[model samples]
Target: MKQFAMLIYPGFTALDLIGPQTVFSTFRDAKIHLVWKTLDPVTTDAGITLLPTASFDTCPEELEILFVPGGVEGTIAVMKDGEVLDFLAARAEQASYVTSVCTGSLVLGAAGLLRGYRATTHWAFREMLPLLGAEPVDARYVEDRNRITGGGVTSGIDFGLRIDAKLQGEEAAQLA
Candidate 1:
């Protein structure tokens, strides 16, 4: 099975994670991991709570996708979190695709995974990409090699569909 690890943290935007997750769930041979520092319930900015299925320590060493979702205050805090960054950096080395939605690209940047890559994020955070060593792009989503990043919250659906097309073909993505 293809393993997908999606990072979750307090205050994440629900749509940023769920939209893509809904798309990924359509894959027949993929296993999704809602990962966090611990296997605790993480609440979203919209007050939705999600339980993580894996902790940083328990996430698979090799993965088909390593994903991060965006937030407001929570994102800013995660960007400076050494443990989270370390986990992302380590897992990214072995992941087939490293991805994010909305401001989640900032978290990838914090992990030093976006340096020298073209990426996009929520419009408000686009300028901040340069500070993190990435070339900012204005688009619904930008894919640079193995890194795929989406714009604001709603753009996650488009991002997920695009990734689904890449992995499972256009017909599969269209059906989704």
Candidate 2:
């Protein structure tokens, strides 16, 4: 089975997380894991709550993908969290793909995972990527090596489809 681990934190933008998740769900052999530091409810920026299905401590040792979704304030704070960054970095080292939507790319950068990668994010924060050592690009989505990031929230679907094709094949992405 293919396993995917998605990080969840308070104030994460709903669309950034949900759009890609919807696409991933269609794969019958894929196991989607909503992971947080704890197995508790995380409040999104939209005020909706999402219950985490797995905890960081219990995440699968191996994963096909490691995803992070962004929120403006949350992303800023997450960038400074050592434990979270450490977890993400370690996971990225092992996963086949390390991805983010919107400003989630900043979080990946904070983990020291995107040192020389070309990436994209919410337009307003594109300039800020330089602070984290990522080359900022203006695009709906970007793919550099195994690190992919989407621009803004709605672009999650586009990023997801790209990831689907990488995970499965062109035909699988077409079906989605």
Candidate 3:
């Protein structure tokens, strides 16, 4: 089974998390883990509450995909969080794909995962990418090496389908 880990924190955008997750769900025998620092419920920017399936310490050591979702206040806070960054960095080392949606790229950049990588994020935050050692691109999504980043919120579906095609196949992505 393919293991996918998605990071969740208070104030994350619901669409950012749900879009990709919906696509990932179509994968056969895949395990999607909603991970956080603890097994507590996280509230999204849209006022939706999501339950975490795994804590950072309990997440799989190896992952097929390591994903992060983005929001305004939450993204900023996560960028400055050492523990979350450390966990992301460690898991990313073994993940087949390291991905983000919207401002989630900023969080990955904070973990130093986007350095020297060509990436994309929400348009409003594009200028800030250079500061994180990433070359910002204006597109729905950008893929550099094993790193794939989606643009603004709704772009996550496109990003997820792109990844699905890469991991599965064009036919599978279309089916998804």
Candidate 4:
């Protein structure tokens, strides 16, 4: 079975996490690990709560994919969270694919993973990517080889489907 890591942050959008989670979890052969800066329970901007399976430093290192879901608090995270950025930076070195949704793309930018890559984020944050040296793409989902980005919250489902196809195959993705 392949493993995927989902990074959770305070004020994250619920659909950004839940949509991809549902699509990935539908496959019995896949393992999804929800990770956070710490192991404590985290709350979403919409008030959904999740108990992280592990902390950033304790997550499995051999993940097949890493998914960063956007939050309402993207700017603050980009500017303030060293642990989140460090973890993302380190993980990007080994993860087969790095992906994000909505302002989650900002987190990737913060980690320096999206530099020079064409990516997309929430419509509201589209203009901010240039500040990080990323080419902003306007799309529900954009797959730039190893990096996959999606726009807005619900776009996570589309991101998941695209990744599923890449990692598994169109038939397996359809089954998922």
**Model 1, range 4-121, lDDT digits (tens) per residue?**
9999999999999999999999998999999999987999999999999999999999999999999999999999999999999999999999999999999999999999999999
C-alpha lDDT values of all predictions: 0.97, 0.92, 0.97, 0.85
Candidate 1 error regions (>4 Å)? none
The superposed Cα distance between candidate 2 and the true structure at residue 66, in angstroms, equals 0.4
lDDT of 3 by residue, 1-176 (tens): 99999999999999999999999999997999999999989999999999999999999989999999999999999999999999999999999999999999999999999999999999999999999999999999999999999999999999999999999999999999
Error of 4 at 115 (Å): 0.5
Residues forming the 10-long window of minimal summed lDDT in candidate 1: 36-45
lDDT of 2 at 173: 92
The residue ranges of model 4 lying beyond 4 angstroms of the native Cα positions read none
After TM-score superposition, the amount by which residue 91's alpha carbon in candidate 2 deviates from its true location, in angstroms, is 0.7
Estimate the Cα RMSD of every predicted model relative to the unseen true structure: 0.5, 0.8, 0.5, 1.4
Give model 3's TM-score versus the native structure: 0.99
Instruction: Please give each candidate's TM-score.
Output: 0.99, 0.97, 0.99, 0.94
What lDDT score is found at residue 60 in candidate 4? 83
Q: Residue pairs in steric clash, candidate 3?
A: none
Model 4 C-alpha lDDT per residue in residues 20-79, reported as the tens digit of each score = 888888775768899987888888888888999988878888778898888766435544
